[model samples]
Structure formats: structure tokens, C-alpha cells
Target: MIQVAFYDIAEESLFDFAVIIAIKEGKWILCRHKDRRTWEFPGGHRDPGEWIEDTARRELYEETGAEHYTLQPVCAYSYLRQGEKASFGMLYYAQVDELGPLPAFEIEEVKLYDKFPEKKDFWTYPDIQPFLLRKVSGLGIK
Candidate 1:
């Protein structure tokens, strides 16, 4: 089983990835990778010496074309696989004010949803994503 933990302090060097849960006009923004059918939030690994928050912004723009937006850090989180060391990441909430054409990046498509779909088949990382979604929802995002 994978285990997830939340920490109050976001130690910059410890975080390896950044993910943004974006909202545009009350709807959720999601992305589909060019190589995968499942949907996921815009996120990626941190570039060397890049601030974690910048990682979220860069990935969000690269994957979703969100040119204008306000981003807020939600929390710092870590997940541990059964045999691997814990991997740390920072989660963010983005209120997108504008979007341009999708960039020709790794993502194939960007979409909006009134609410997260109930079907588990829609997610790229089923087990992990649901937990992340629930954490965001707990913030009263809706």
C-alpha cells in the first residue's frame, strides 16, 4: 500500500515534484498526456535549483496554457511506496483567470469539468489522485 503524509513546513530541497489543482470559473481544469488516455492535473518533477512553486507554475502553463492565474500553496505532502523511500511534493490551488492555446508539450489536451467525475477510470493515478482531490476538497474549494 502507498502511504501519504502531510507536513506543515515545505522544505524546499525535500520536495521533488509540484502539482496544481486548478479552477477556472468554478470548474476544474485537467489534462491528458499525449501518451496516456487517463486524465491528471498539471504537474511534473522539479528542475534543478528551481523553486517548487515555480515548478507548479511552469508545469501548469506548459500543460494547460494557463497564462494568467493566481496560485496558492495548499500543503506539502509525501508519499511512500511499499519498498521505496518517501517522495515529497507540494500541492497548489490555482484560480486561472486566462488561458491561451495549449502548448505543443507532453500534454495532448486540456479540459474543464463542473466537478470531479465519479468514475475511477478517468484518473491517471487512481489511488493517489483521489486522496489528493479529497484533500483539496477539504479546503472548501467548491
Candidate 2:
């Protein structure tokens, strides 16, 4: 089984990745990776010595061409699968105001959604992404 848990922002240093659940013009933004047909939030691993917030911004621009946005740290989350060590990431919520051309990256394309799509098989990280989305939604993110 895959287990997920939330952490206080005070645990920031434990985070290894940064994921952005972003919105543009009232719609959610989702990205498709070049190697997979599944959709996912714009996010990525932190670079050596880089700030977690910078990881969020860099990944957002590289994946979705999100040029202008207001980003806020939503929470920290960790996920663990049976027989595997837990992985940690910080979650961010962004209200995007502008976009530029997508940089050549692992992400193949980005789509805007009126709501997170209901198709279960469409997600790249079904075990974790949807749960995170739901948590953020309950906090009144739109």
C-alpha cells in the first residue's frame, strides 16, 4: 500500500522535491510527460543547494511555461510504499497570470482544466497526486 502524510512547513528541509498545483485563469493546470501518457502537476526535484521555492518556479516554467504567477507553499507531504523508503516533497499552490513558450523539457504538453479530471487512469502519480489535490481543494483553492 502507498501511504501519505502531511508535515508542518517547519519540516521544510526534509523535502526532496517541490510540486506545484497551479491555476491559470480559473482553471487547473496539468502536464503530460514525454515518456508517459499520464497527466501530472508541474514539479521536480530540488537542485543541489537550491531553495525549494526556486525548484517550484523552475519546474513550473519548464513544464508549463508559467511566466507570471503568485506562489504560496501549501504544505509538506511524504509518501511511502510498501518495502520502499518514504520520499518527501513540498506542495505549492500557484495562481498563474501569464505564460510564455514552453521550454524544451521532459513535459510534452500542458492542459488547463475546469476541475481536476475525473479519469483515474490519466494520472501519472495516482497514488499520491489526487490525494494532494483533494487536500488543497478542501482549503478553498480554486
Candidate 3:
């Protein structure tokens, strides 16, 4: 099982890696990797010299083509990779307005859903969404 850590954006005590659980209006944003067929949240590694919050903003825009949005750090999370290795990322929630053309990159497509999709197993990191939802619910998404 993936373990979760929740924190306020102000606390700012997570690793450089980040993932954003973006919500536009009332829907959630998900992306399909160009190389990998599976879908996942809009986020990526915090590049050298980039802040975690900036990483979240950049990744969200790059992946989803979200033009105008409000992004906020909801939590910092860690999970067991390959059932043993520990991996961590910052979790963010976004309220997006306008979406523009997608930038040519690792992302192939972007999608929105009112709730978790039916074929949830197709999600890139199976534990990510549920864990994020549970943690955000536990902490409350602001």
C-alpha cells in the first residue's frame, strides 16, 4: 500500500519532485504519456533550480495546456516503489479556466472527468489518484 503525507503549501517541506491533481471548474485533469499508453495526473520532476510550486505549475501547463489556473500545494507524499523502493512527490490541486493548444511534448492527450474514470486500472500510477483523493479529503482540498 502507498503511504501518504499531507501538508499545507506554506509548510513547504517536501522533495523536489511534484505531481498536481488538477481540477478545472469541477472536473479533474488527466494526461496520456506520449510513449506510455497509460494515463496519469499532470506533473513531473522538479527540474534543477526550480521550486516545487513552480514545478507543479509548469508541469500542469505543459501537460494539460491549462492557460489560466490557480494552483496550490495540498500535500507531500511518499509511496513504495516496486513494493520496496521509496518514492516521493509534492501534490497540488488546481482550479483551471482556459485551456490552449497542447505543447508538443511527452504528453499525448489531456482529458477531464467528473469523477474517477471507470477503467481506473489504466492510470499510470495506480496508487496516486486514490491516495491523493484520500489525503486531500483527509486534509480538505482548498
lDDT of 3 by residue, 1-142 (tens): 5755555543344465788877776777889998887888888887887788888888888999999988777767776655676666788788889889999988999988777756866788876667777676565543
Q: CA shift at 117, candidate 1, in angstroms?
A: 2.7
lDDT of 2 by residue, 1-142 (tens): 8999987664657779999999998899999999999999999999998889999999999999998899999889999999998999999999999989988988888999997657889899999998899888989988
Better of 1 and 2 by lDDT: 1
Prediction RMSDs, each to the true structure = 0.9, 1.1, 2.8
Q: What is the C-alpha lDDT of each candidate?
A: 0.92, 0.91, 0.77
Which candidate achieves the best lDDT against the true structure?
1
Off by over 4 Å in 2: none
lDDT of 1 by residue, 1-142 (tens): 8898888786789999998999999999999999999999999999999999899999999999999999999999999999999999999999999999999989999999997777868999886887888899999996
TM-score for each model: 0.96, 0.95, 0.83
lDDT of 3: 0.77
By TM-score, the candidates rank as 1, 2, 3
Q: Check candidate 2 and list the clashing pairs.
A: none
